[model samples]
Target chain A: MSASDHLIPVVVSNVVEVNPIIKRFEFKHVNGDELPAFSGGAHIVVEMLDDGTKRKNPYSLMSSPFERDQYAISVRRDDTGRGGSKFMHEQVRPGMQMKISAPVNLFALDLRARKHLMIAGGIGITPFIAQMAQADKLGVPFELHYAARSVSQAAYMDSLADRFGDHVSCYCDDQGESVDLETLLSNQPLGTHVYVCGPKGMIERVVQTATSLGWPAAHVHFEHFLAPPVGEPFEVHLAKAGIDITVGAEQSLLEAVEASGTPINCMCRGGACGQCETVVVACDGEIMHNDHWLDEEQRAAKQRIMPCVSRFRGKRLELDL
Target chain B: MTIQFKDESFRGDFTYANSPSNIPRFPFPFPEDEYMYSTNIEPHHAARAGSPFENAFDVDEHYVAEMKDRALVLADDPGRCQALPHMETAGWDFLELVMVSKARDYPDLFKLTMDGDRWHWINKPLQIDDTFTFGDSSTLPCHPMEYIGRQVQGDHAILDQRDGNLWMDAGIITAQADWSLDFDIGMNFFEWHAPVPLAHELGVFQRALKFLLTLPQGQPSRRLNWTLTVNPRLDTSPENYPKWGPDRMTVTPENIGEKVHLRVELQTFWRLPRSNAILFPIRTYLMAMNEVVTQPKWGRRLHRVMRDLRPELVDYKGLSRYHPILVEWLSQFDDGAPTSPGIFPD
Candidate 1:
């Protein structure tokens, strides 16, 4: 089947600016049927068609899983990044028809955990919104430590506090409030799982502190979808598909391949999901590894590449796409 | 369409026999004249009407007898149904998946009603009607997995995903083909499949595991696997090998058509919504050589596939005992004619 065959048609039912930077968009099935059920920490790839160009961006579903009639996602407009989020903010309006992929969870909760500790930064609070709702329904104890720029910039602060009571903790950078990762990671109960989603620095600090505090690697979880960085233009030869595509300076390798009419199954266009991993048949220059999927050893081996974000800076590069 | 439930037996008297109409729809596993280990997974979309692939869960004429046999096996050994303590939520997820799918796909045979958390389920085929809270296990008569598993055909295994691997955490497997769920519980995907010959060296499991790890919520996939069985026995498990092993030796040239059977498993994989675990259902279909030859296409292709089958696979699938006699008997059905490309009656 073609890649677009599985997309679910949806209509923008409502849009609300939660904060100056974040806008919450509610999507309902175009035919008013119940959307597919999803679990906590799941994300859907919203497909945006603009000027004959297709852009897909993964956004965490902030609505509760039980609410199947509509799905809600909070988008933090990235002015400097690719045009997907900008389209969501400016062009997208109520009654507009669009398509989105089914929910895929790369950061699902560990149900066996006795306690859950969540850390969020800015838009990172999106996934935790649904997760907190699930934890409450399951009667599992959890605590949220969320940090934003300030009270005015914090999205869903009041409603979260009002609904979750003392379980919600807000930290504002302007007020000199920051999460103490070391203190948060120390002396937690056994079987406590820590999930952190935020900026690169914040996620690294949480992971490092948890490790230094003797937490097992399995108990530490993090989700960060890296936007493909702009790189110099390069040429890639699709050996199996018998096609050649040029990775423009502004476009990702995945976009270039998709434009060539090659069926590449991708879920989370971001670097986190390994769905778009391709074998590096040959390369004359260095392979820029920017994805979170491959290990240090695999990256050094240079036999595989995550086309979503990774790039090639060489005279000749071939992929077994 | 209403189904005509068959009153038959899978053990003891061994009175199981497929009706004449059911033979054409028998999921003949060989799409070609030869078979080897390949991923071979395809989208589990609903296909041709009246075929087994037409529903999320296929309920055939043997549904009543199969459920009865499962109950007998479970009564003899409760160890067949097992679930890890941490898999309770997954069990609930599995119960919801089956109840919802069956009620929607086969409305004539099943019904489900939901009022918030309160759920009422009815199974016309099994004469079961019960109401329970959606997520509360105490509301059900047994564990959610076991409670719903008993009402469905085939054996169901709930796989838990973590640390980049799938774990066989919970399952109700009474109709298995030699594998034991009790021993396989808590084993990772590779660990449970370690005993399978040749698939690992060929990188089949690696590719399959990677695909399943990202299996989306709505799109499920399925593949077919087959083995040879002597009788229409659903409980050819290793634990009960002695009771059924001797049946293989009873096959002779005269009784090969009646005594030997071809067992095909339509294994499907689905992603659970709540727990993010995968539900694997192995639906077994049995057809005696006599019923198989009724479909000329199946008879011709089965003979060619069996005659050219790899020696390793013949031993692996336990076809060594009666392989020569069975293949020789099937040779008469093959009249040196080229069969059609796909697996369907000519």
Candidate 2:
């Protein structure tokens, strides 16, 4: 499963619907039968095999983290997406025993203070519902700010408002407007933490506000609905392997290594996890680490690399893979 | 996108979770942003907050930086107030814990206390007067009929007798530093959550795999505990979820001067219902990284990539968009884990 599952998956044994774009399945894993407790902003990754080759794609976990019984996730019919998401939406169906992974999360609610500021664009509201339910049960606190192109395309609104009361704030581009970043951020009491999930611009804007407020980068968090494009390239050395390969500007370090027949076990090719980690053999280049898998110390030391999506910092570098 | 409020004047260090001593005691990696923004620094200040709640999280970096070597703890962390902004979605009772030390990562933030079921920003705190008969029995949930008495802190606050839950909680950021009713800032109790994989038991994926348990009832699958961080790209990506709950989780017997090594494992499975009609039940695996070794590998890879992309491309925005949080997958190697592929493949 992708990192978002929180290492907990909602099991489904029945396929209620299937199409080239989405798959609706069901299962049981309650707290005696309880599925794991997943916060809002969580997701599940599915593994597929078109020809005995494994393929995995992460999808949004729409089920509320508050629900005890069965949970649900809605996946787009990503035909253009690799076999993982596209496969689930296209060919898989009901009564079939489908396996899912536990949820490993990067997105959870703020634990310290009372109050949650949820910003969801398009289908990003899925996980917020779960957090909302949990928030309700604890009476700790939270608010949902949902923004979408239109209400029709918006996943859930009325249910969220009804359950949450005046806490639900709506912003839709279709209405010729959307959330006012400055006003929203400015109006918030200092203790409140921010969470946003949606397109690139929306997430970035929120982060900017948080940063501008001098909120430590850690406080204002967001989950990108999609990955940004890759840029530049350079050489990486596999120290242990004593191999150095030149990554052309457009070429991924992974592609170059794989092309040379140096097998590196990699699962998520998008550089979201620490799967394709290659150690530094030696280097004389700038290091631009992009993976969350590394901590502050590693980033400071400058030895490893995620060849799949990472690029070189200097003219050359080294890896220990 | 983030909504900016006009008033930036926040007073009072967020007395998140704290212990009963004059030590900085909030856990590092404060949950989602249950942050502490205190510029208060004292050597041996200890004040007991008579209110309800327990724990600490989200220490303001500026505050943390100032209180380089101190201990802070909340004997009882008050529940998240409902009237706060964004109160609708963040519901649940929460207790925070934290500790600040002159030492680096391991010693900086330590000690913790918590329950199996977590508390959130919305839930009420436990009360000494509140009681229920629960002993690992299998029963569905429903509202209960139990009552608790109240405990007041001079004129500062009131708490439930059973569990020390407070009612009519006052504001922290909103309150003035001079607000007498708010928690006294001079105390240095340390509220904290011990890191899951306790410092002593760091292991690779292969060895870490032993601590896994399958679903006792549902289709046989497992789950694992993991931490998240932004990497590969500095951007943690659009997929990274926020940790909205308590930032600090305590290791057992934290105050008794004991430590337990943790082993987070990997659990793999598919999400499908057994009763529904389906042809193929897809199987997938999830895992927690063997953090000790894997983190280094990630650092190595990322350094090279950054060197390749150059600084202009290394802006926080590009990096934040790509950072991957704690992701788990089936381990593919013996000494180490196979590299993770891009979850959001283009």
Candidate 3:
């Protein structure tokens, strides 16, 4: 991953619509020089404009980690998701330069596993592309299970089949072909590790099934695919800054606070990482906790808030900052 | 009239009805003539050897009174009832579970109907009758958990099982004895009981978790946890420290009988059918030490337990300040007192 502290401007060198909802983009240095190298499963935060508001969206690098000439990312257009993906789909174009943070790997491949089991739902397949490449380099036995609504929705299926052949399996819900996750989890070997990235319901089901079947939690992994649900606009008071920031209906608390000149540290921006949790001084209303990082008790405490995805609907909220 | 206390906290209009039959079957908790935290997983329907109640969730004469007390607590602080965002479904599951069970158990008080994704609930006791879309939070008059919790005479929590562990995620905990729901939400079963002295060494928590994960759908299990409280107030959460903490330090022999309460929690655990979350209902019963000694055996047991309890255990139970006084007061009955509190009658 890049060690630079500042974000670098990268040009959108190429774009391809792999499916109805997914667009794969290739980014390269503006001067056409080799970009910073990143390991498998690393993601770079792309800074985009959502109707003039600054938005940072993290996208996993799908390109092989062995090279650094360009970086690849896939964005799924989710009309129902937060506005970041919508902006990436409609506004971003080739030849346009966008600011991107250094790559960071929050879902890196485990090097010690005897075998790897990769599961994906829809666009969740992006992270596994780079991970499988690393597993190949390590000569690790692996299986890639891809599930999609249909053949058309399964992005990169042909490429994966061409590369891994029988090691890749695709299940399309439209065609009535389904993967029995219980059976898949039950048949795994002793030292095998399973990685799942998908919609919330799918991830919960896979994790629960694996756990019920006695699969060790250490061997299971998952990443959330979409942002949390949005709530009404609210006002935030930064104690240290002594300013009351009005977070818009579509804006996250983290974005509003950052736009006001006090940037909070953040990683995934999807509420999966715990980097942006800020101490809440006082709250007069209920907090809609949207982070996967905090457990139920922490969410209920009202003492802390994950500014990235969490929001509130109240007159005023005070943050310790 | 509201009798105001020295701590600025006042007791609501309470009539001290001391009929032994009205005691509502306290689940004596201590087994083998000693006290220790163990897995102690018993079948939900299993009859307690000496209990006056028969069902997993037993409602007694105090149901209406306790519900009234809960309503007062909630009115003063609505933060006492919170159902996290993801727990919306579990809340509905809880609502339906109570309505259906109550409709079946006490047919006159509750009724539930289902038509596809819509449900109609009739709570005769609360005078609520409405038809709303299932799984929609807005359709309900209040948060689903609070709506049900307010009607019942117990504190309830929903624990979701994920990744081979149960998470104490959602609940309306208006009457926590000494624990804080704010600090325990989303915590695993073990983290919730970390303060217990020897549960870890005895593998009690592990055994309990295993038993809970394997608990069948309709079959609930129950266990007991007991402690001493300064008053009959149910909201003993740390958030109310300033209001109740000093009373613990000021208690003495003169008022120990009236100030000290033997608090026993009859905790019932069962799995929700729809959400698959475990529904835990904790019913608390508090009796003044003076009223308890009316039962000679119980008085002697309380005296012996308080005297022999380890110092660390007593401190952890929050009885370090006035326990010695409590022990002294119970010693008067050590040589066998009368079968009644003759001088303490209402």
- The lDDT of each candidate is 0.90, 0.40, 0.75
For model 1, residues B79-122, the per-residue Cα lDDT tens digits are 99999887888888888888888999999899999998899999
Q: Which residue pairs collide, candidate 1?
A: none
Model 3 ranges off by over 4 Å: A1-321, B1-18, B46-53, B114-118, B335-346
Q: Best candidate, TM-score-wise?
A: 1
lDDT of 1 by residue, A110-132 (tens): 88889899999999999999999
| TM-score per model over all chains | 0.95, 0.43, 0.52
TM-score of chain A of 2: 0.70
- Ranking of all candidate structures by their lDDT, best first: 1, 3, 2
Minimal lDDT window, size 10, model 3 chain B: B1-10
Q: What tens digits encode model 2's per-residue C-alpha lDDT throughout B1-346?
A: 1111122111133222212221122111112111122211111112233211111111222223112111111112222111223221111111111111111112323222223432111111211222223211122122110010011011111111001111222211111111222332221111111221222233432222211111111122322222232111111112212321112132122211111111111212211121010011111111112322133333233323323433332332223222221111111222333334421101
Please say which candidate is ahead in lDDT: 1 or 3: 1
User: Model 3, A150-231: lDDT tens per residue?
Assistant: 8988899888999999889999999998779989999988988899998888899999999999988878888886365566
Cα shift from native, residue A262, model 2 (Å): 10
- Show the colliding residue pairs in model 3: A296-B185, A296-B186, A297-B185, A297-B186
lDDT of 3 at B69: 68
TM-score, chain B, model 1, is 0.99
